[model samples]
Target: MTAQRSGAGANDGSTHRPRVAVFRPDDDRLRDAVALLDSLGVKPVADSMLAVEPTGALPRDDAAFVVFTSKTGAELVAEEWTAGEETVCAIGEPTAAALREHGISVDVVPETFSSTGLVDALGDSVDGSRVEIARSDHGSDVLPEGLWDAGAYVHETVLYRLVRPDDAGESVRLAAEGDLDAALFTSSLTVEHFLAIADERGQREAAIEGLRAAVVGTIGEPTRETATDHGIDVDVVPHTADFEALTEAVLDRLEGE
Candidate 1:
């Protein structure tokens, strides 16, 4: 069942409408999440951690396989993909669909949307193969490293750069005022960039203390360590490391507490 909260400006007076800060890049995912929050009478403020920009280059290598881990990555490839010799692999359904939308057929798609999941799905397939991974400039080294260890000749290229958002000043001001009830961190990059913005504005500690946090929840040791280093206690992390899971976890935590 879909959970509902009741409070002033919410469904009823019993539940308070919480203002959530979204610390993601300005993209479709962020827009969808914001719309969902609006439907629930919750206010969502954009504290975008990164801004995306295209790197003008077409992927040309007719490699054995191509890998994509995010919808943005897939879209960037589709913008310049014109080869027929390579098979495409996606980390999630959305990325696969993006490829299909570009009239490209995906050869492999992991059931889960994590790097570990992708590695498991590609287990023996990548051995002795040449795979090209297209992703953001600031992505993790998990996929490339794992593939290399498994005997694949992995080639990587950055298709986009995640820069700090231009309106970050407004976000910092709002956070300083304690207007945001909570902030969602979907990636370690989001956590890092958000803190960087806070630190630049001289409001790091206050921002951390004021807002409740929920991470998209990585199983990676490094992700957990990064969160800890920033002094941000992760309030809720779902079993599945996806945005839907993150939302449910946040809602459950807010309802319970």
Candidate 2:
């Protein structure tokens, strides 16, 4: 469905309908994004950029508590690991909501919803605590490092790994062809992979600067640094991880004010 709001799109003062390229995992993550885009009357080109690969490791049933950094991580843990007496700590509301849907009550949902946010929210409770952190193999070291420093006994399980999907390059090509008015990055990994694909297509600078950027939380913060290096000004950031907020960020950019 093509969603075009009147007087929204392009900075040239033309009434062009804005099209946005979305690079997210192809689960509810992508679905929810599309739903929000539809509600906002903005067209979205849904593109799957990352796929989750299971590592065949489950969270230890005997752990004191468990930490989930992403919705995918929570989903994987909920699927393979039975709920014990462990308190679940979900890094973000989306991840926490995913766990709650499975009859799980999350003990903590951080304000920032990042690794550092998780550590900070857990506070001294993490001290002398045995926490099992489930995330991708290539995830940031902030959680483990913070837990260790806080005197927590950290047991980490690589529940999944993120692999670049084959269609990502095509999505980058579509963006480079001026088919996209904006690009929304929900994760830093997406930013890295998108830039890599653009670099491979030999228009990394143009792709980085030519389109408007809307980021979610700190996920898109790192991308802004990269975009700034290419002289691209980031247009908006939801600062919250919610898809609805992200949709608004896109709408704000589409209006070109």
Candidate 3:
């Protein structure tokens, strides 16, 4: 999600700059969110719950079409200097934008921005195609399974592994602090990791209950459910799953408060 313009506001003549806890694994997207928050005069507690570490080697020119479940996976292709030109399918708009920055035209982006939506979107094209489903270490299974059912020659690439930061102590502490006005969760894993880190630091309950009124912007419905399961009350879920929308939603929510 690239940065988009929005207006700034403060409640009741208070100089309280609303702070947000942001957790997205990709660098570009995190930057975009940070920039948006900065533009709105909101202080962002920017820290990724998960860090992307490259793991498996990328197969050279092996795919006619590839599915990227995360922006980090799509960026790895550019970082490793892998040859472009393969038809790419990104799980969401941000991943597509990242690929487009490298001049790779995205063939498809799921209307629903989920694995099932991508599977349905690729229906006939996947058949007889050399497809690669590339993602982080704890990669998902539904996309590859659906492609195989479509009769595609599929290769799974674990380009990187997403691990919780070793020094999440500060992040967890800040998240639970009363001054934190909002929290942004880009994925279900982010919610899980945020809570896990808080729990690890013995602040899970306060972090969850304390932020009860904070505008929790979950990127999608599934992530909303995960946030709900963690007892995080979600205040907004954008129609499109991108940081551009998330930033807008957070701003709108803050304005309405």
Best-fitting candidate, scored by lDDT: 3
Best by TM-score: 1
Q: Report the C-alpha lDDT of model 1 over 150-214, residue by residue, as the tens digit.
A: 88998887888878776764555666676665566777787787778789889988777665332
For model 1, the superposed segments whose C-alpha errors exceed 4 Å read: 1-8, 11-15, 169-179, 212-224
TM-scores of the candidates are 0.86, 0.83, 0.81
User: Model 1 Cα displacement at 59 (Å)?
Assistant: 2.8
RMSD in Å for model 1:
3.3
| Tens digit per residue, CA lDDT, model 3, 19-123 | 777886647667877777877777778877878888756744778887888877777776554446777788988788887888777888989888878989888
Clashes of each: 3, 0, 0
TM-score (C-alpha) between model 1 and the true structure: 0.86
| Per-residue alpha-carbon lDDT of candidate 2 for residues 142-194, written as tens digits (9 for 90 to 100) | 78999999889998889999988977765577666756666776666777787
Model 3: pairs clashing at backbone N, Cα or C within 3 Å: none
- The alpha-carbon lDDT assigned to residue 3 of candidate 2 equals 36
Question: How does each model score on lDDT?
Answer: 0.72, 0.72, 0.76
Alpha-carbon shift of residue 105 in model 3 (angstroms): 4.3
In terms of TM-score, how similar is model 2 to the real structure? 0.83
